[model samples]
Target: MYSRISTVALLARALSDQAESYDYLLAGAGTAGLVIACRLSENPKVSVLVIESGPDVRNDGVVTSGNFSFTGANDRVLSYRAGKAVGGRSIVNGMVYIRGEQAQFDAFEKLGDSEWNWDSLFSYGKKGERFEGPDTAQKTAGVTANPADHGTNGSLTTWKSIGVNPVTDINGGNPHGFVSAPQTLDRDKIRRSSSAAAYYKPVDSRPNLKVIQGNMKRIIWANEKKNRAVASGFYAKEEKLGVKVKSAMPGVGENMQDHNAMVIGYGTANTLVGDTPFATLVTAQDALGNKMPVLAASSRSQISTWAQAASTYTGGAIDAKTYEKRFQIQHDLIFKQNVTIAELFPTNLGSAIVSQLWTTHPFSWSSVHLKSLVSFDDPVIDPNIFSLQFDIDMLVAVARKEQKAYSTPPLSTFVAPNQVLPTNATDEQWTAYVQANAGNTLHVVDTCAMLPLDLGGIVDSKLKVYGTSNMRVVDASVIPVELTGHTTGPLYAVAEKAADIINNDS
Candidate 1:
């Protein structure tokens, strides 16, 4: 019977043939799930199965950062904007690689001294990073060589942008005055090609490793006398595959949440020269056969590139020399100067820059829950985005700060003397403008939080679900607290640590 079945057959058959039984069944091969799957399958003795809710992203242009021109959503592979894709949001993520501030991790310890404290978790963070990019710049900017800060050897490839238009000055300092964005991309600058590419691809050849494509609706529960569930699996629907429970093991889908975001757009007079368009800069390239200036990018990368475009078009000057002078002045007049430091990204056209001011650390909370028992349905995501008043107040403050930054001395002469969004120019006017155009940060987290049992937590200190024996939640959903920087880096670290935990336990 085994000989009759081809290797091209279903994962169920492959899994059945490989081992008498597999040790783990991972669901939702998103950013975190894939990491866990690969690590657990590393053992020659253990067998693992990874059930993805979307299709394969092998050559999908939309999922590959190299194909920056393909702006349309890839419904076939990634589950972005409600599409059933395999790579999950990583397929369409901004790919902004950032670590949580030391204080943020320390704060978690203060909040109860859980296993995820800065001291205990730092090693895991180091294990997940694969830092690349120019060493001098990364070091001078406090990016590399700081063993206390950065990780050199890890699975997820993190580095400064390559193929990036040179914005540097003669001194070779950062052209934009700030550190280059550490992106969650490969050495090639491809987005969505995360640990999945590094771990899953190679390991897929292993006899014990099985990766399947399907939707994940909910956890199938196996009761043990009482109503309390004992074991679990995924409930999914496929056209030819039909409805089935691929996972013999169980997982809990209880805890869920996401970070809130708001973007600010500023207008420019000319077609400003920047990286691409929008606040979230993922990928950008000049139009083929024409350098006159046309950008193609995913929505996430558009934000920063668009902002840079705005800067160039509106004539907001930025270069190494200018920023260096500004930095020097600010350093000398530390307290004296009213500095409003912020992040900026350039777009391709160089016409307009969408100045995005996200709250970064939102005080409000929300969650994602299952809509029904069936697989292939979207989850009920109630992010309650922008519900908190503090978030709004922060955005307003940031707007005022941006206005002042552009209005300051040397910079003022270069940048236009008017507000691009609210022409009238007041805090109130800025707030109104922001309210109408602000959007999400896409850093969703905290539904399946790892907290102490007394704190209404879903997972334990080790990331194992509280009620279940073998079940664990390792994605961003399990993060108890929001980080100061973007979530991708920290999440990768969490997944790496989770892998160690699962491997040791198994």
Candidate 2:
């Protein structure tokens, strides 16, 4: 009877009294969380409550200007302390907004649900986008953009807001080639376009939506009704309270995936000019003067190159045959259509031109789970980054390509050969370097993956939690596999679609 629940999100502090009941009580005001909240509350009759553990630092100068460290959760490959700010990672991220290959999304349908194909998600992707096409100065530096391929209207936007095979406009669904990344900045290239800025700011005035700055400590559980797996709720409480385990869904926090990345440097013939990382800086006199030309990212990428002969790692319910069907899409994208598999970009750090690269189609597997019975304790986020031999091989091939890039006419003119970098390095040296240095790109997904129940899936095509009557996960965690682009763009698409699903059900 509770299956038709809907939720909408905004980070407005609980202005007055907390309501005794709400149509939806969302545990997070995160990336997709707020998007779902906002969409669900579109119906004025539906009351939505968004709970945020972090403070609302929406316009805090310190938060906007730079980054701060938060202590919690360490990956097995390395330690990265990510904070839970009001806007989630969008506020403190690199602000690179990009879409993965079309085939990648289309493969989602094959993996489990027909409704999750790229064609449908492609629209949702553009739904929240407010794309700012490359300006004349940007175009002068080899930047290209398709105006039609971008959305002119949306809350999450440039200011607002791959691959081994080479294709133009990764947002067009086929990620390949060397191209400039799409930014999540505004028209002036100042201030990051977070979900708070794009989706919530305008709608914060809505009477039906409310946000509280605090953690959701527990959900008072109810007895099983209609003989359901886990009926009504799940909870967290003091040990003395002694909560009993209701049910166990083995796929709660398994099947984790993240892009393993490492930065390789090249000694430059000329001393680096700008403080920001990149090949060249395009500038105009903004309010802060021309000291810095607003930071932007440029990358050269290609397919994994080993696509034709790549192997898959199969376990759990996804047997060899099922895994083969899943991997065959990636193989065809690289070998058949020649889509870009890895992303390589240059950043001018210190005296060297550092090239940051990561493989997009990682088959390696890992898991993240709570360390103890406590709910709020940081989960053990152990991503076996180099779990696949294929990942290392891909990084080596990308390094080889970078060597060629450094040897090219213009770059060769000013860049010196690396004394201890991937430039001109041997395959053996590259492999060792990758194994020692590779870390996450922060493009993580699939922990609470959406797939078939027997296939280690925690959520369904509608994103409803497997055993729960009303609870659903509408974030990157529900994604079943890695894709060619950053998780941000696709996550927004996922939320957009999720909102519609919830609203329709309501």
What is the alpha-carbon lDDT of model 2 when measured against the actual structure? 0.62
Q: Per-model C-alpha lDDT, please?
A: 0.48, 0.62
* Candidate 1 C-alpha lDDT tens digits along 212-321: 77544445455542433344454343333333442221112322334334444445555544243222211111111131123112222333443343234224423223
lDDT per residue for candidate 2 within 1-506, as digits (tens), equals: 12333322222344333324567777778878778777878789888777777877788876565332211112334654454866787777766677777766776787777699888988898888988876786666556677767788810011111112223365776545555677677746466788877888778889988877765554544555555443332122234344455545666666677776767677887786632312111111110122212210000112232221222222343444444554555555444444456666566654787777666666566677776656555777767666556556666665565566666556666678766564556668777777777777777888788888766677889887766656677888888767765778888999999999888875
Q: Per-residue lDDT for 78 in model 2? A: 68
Per-model RMSD to reference:
14.6, 9.7
lDDT of 2 at 485: 57
Kindly report which residue stretches of model 2 are placed more than 4 angstroms away from their true locations once superposed: 1-19, 66-77, 154-168, 223-226, 229-247, 271-338, 421-424
TM-score of 1: 0.67
Clashes of each: 51, 32
